[model samples]
Target: MIFTSERLVVKTITEAHKKEFVELLTAEEIITAIPQQRPSEEDINVKFEKAIGFDGDISKNPLNIFGVFEEGEDELIGLVAFLTNDDGDRELGYRFRKPYWGKGYATEITKRMIDYSFSELKLDKITADVWVENVASNKVLSKFLKPTKEFYNEYDNCTDRRYTLLKEDWN
Candidate 1:
């Protein structure tokens, strides 16, 4: 339930991460990139603490969500997660605070998540979806996942494009 990338640490979220976690989840960027949940300090603290209460237990839930922190910093710059869709596929999801944008952190942590999903977790495929106009997200995903489909999202009022990486296709 922990990962040490070249310059980042992917660790299970804990109550200690409340402040930075709230900052990332409630950033305005989320409404554009990921439009489902409206994160609030109180709400997130309660839910995330319970969901990831046991830091080392990856089997607790397939969500596999973790906080991304700089190697020496205690604050979280962003978060990465695996969520299941209506079709039962584990969708790769990530979001960062506005300051962290354009820093390649998203792509870095994503590669880690994808590697864990396929190589360690033995998943057949990993998928990601972005609002049709989210250029940055689309570009990052394109490196490892191929665009496969597009669907309309009534809630977000935009077309959502889907991308996937198969186990055999991962390198």
Candidate 2:
């Protein structure tokens, strides 16, 4: 397992998770919150490859995606990632299936990931960027990260807000 919280287990995505991964990528709410376009087959395939390729050693790889599942369950409900930004800073990201929403999984897994990043990975700080219209995600991120800036993303054509949390500021 990559990590675990009280109610969730995270692990590197594998072939067993392909169907659910595709479901997540095609979910309407997920599509709206992210790129806001239907994922092409190529897009889905590329992301699946990256998710499965994660080495489970973020300090060395610096970019990895993992599958999130409820403890005692085989269904893959979501994905969380630690990505390297253009400035070489670690960034946090997550997405859950619609049925999994409103159940505190996002907040739970996010907090766990942040703790892991700070304490285990030894990262000084972690960052996140959220689409302005994704209120639920913005709320989840704001709980742990300080809003640093907002800017227009040409690729997604939306105003995005960036947040940061430093190890020194963690409780």
Candidate 3:
């Protein structure tokens, strides 16, 4: 799916985007935000190839991973993804280059994805899990979902806060 906002374009990740995707995804800033997953350039290209033909499902749901590009330059500044959680809730995740931090781009794209999840996907709820120390992400998620739970991430060795927004509360 393609979603365009005033400052950015959120388009589905495609094979054509392999090179850019690799560079952006492996950037230090993105690695810090998404600690669990970091792939080499070759691995990223392979994943992009695999994602080319994705179709959604409740279980093993294919993600709608979009390249977040600035308005004029076709270059990507980041990425945003929506996937179905184990409980059938739509989960949102995103990361941006450090240079793009503090500019409200994350919140803007996030709000757009939330609208798509509720209105287009007809999702019942949207949730995000963010590291407690990642204050920017916490603030962004708080703009949409109230914090409902907390847990420890053994791998990252950090506390994670889970937030959610119900479809009825979205308007």
Candidate 4:
């Protein structure tokens, strides 16, 4: 499944995208945002395998991950994902390369994914958890969703702000 916007092409991960995906996932910016403590080559390979094997079966509730690529160069710039909930809701996640930051790519891909989640997946709602210190992510989510709660992730030791957007809230 590929979704095209004005400046990006959000496509399913493939074997051919492994090398670039590894580079992006391990990039310092991404590591800082998502905190992959030891994102070695082997770890990236495992991620690639999981992403490439994703199938849109609601029962299995596979993660729908997409690589964001530039329109002309077609280079992978970031990743956006929707992990299905047991109740048919979807949790959204995204990260962009440092170079692509501040360019609205995250917001663009996010909005597109939200649309796809509701229209295509027939989901009831979409949710996101952003670290309190991640101002950029907080800003993005604020632009598209409304806050629901605040919580702490014991594993990451970070305060997370939870936001949600119901299908009817989309305009």
Per-candidate RMSD, Å: 2.2, 1.3, 2.7, 2.4
Query: Candidates' lDDT values, in order?
Result: 0.78, 0.89, 0.76, 0.77
lDDT of 1 by residue, 1-171 (tens): 377777889877777877777777666667656665675567676657754664555534656668888898878788877777656788888888888888889889889889888876678998998987888898999988999999997866788999988999988
- Which one wins on lDDT? 2
Show where candidate 3 strays beyond 4 Å: 40-43, 55-60, 155-157
- In candidate 1, position 101 carries an lDDT of 84
Off by over 4 Å in 2: none
Top TM-score model? 2
1-171 in candidate 2: lDDT tens per residue? 888999999998789999999988898878888756787999889889988887557777666778999999989999998888766889999999999999999999999999999988898999998998889999999999999999988877889899999999999
Clashing pairs in 2: none
Q: What TM-scores do the predictions have?
A: 0.87, 0.94, 0.84, 0.86
**Regions more than 4 Å wrong, model 4:** 40-42, 56-59, 85-88
Clashes of 4: 0
Q: Tell me the deviation in Å of residue 134 in model 4.
A: 0.5
Model 4: lDDT equals: 0.77
Stretches of candidate 1 above 4 Å error?
Answer: 40-46, 54-60
Ranking by lDDT: 2, 1, 4, 3
lDDT of 1 at 53: 68
Lowest summed lDDT window (length 10), candidate 4: 56-65
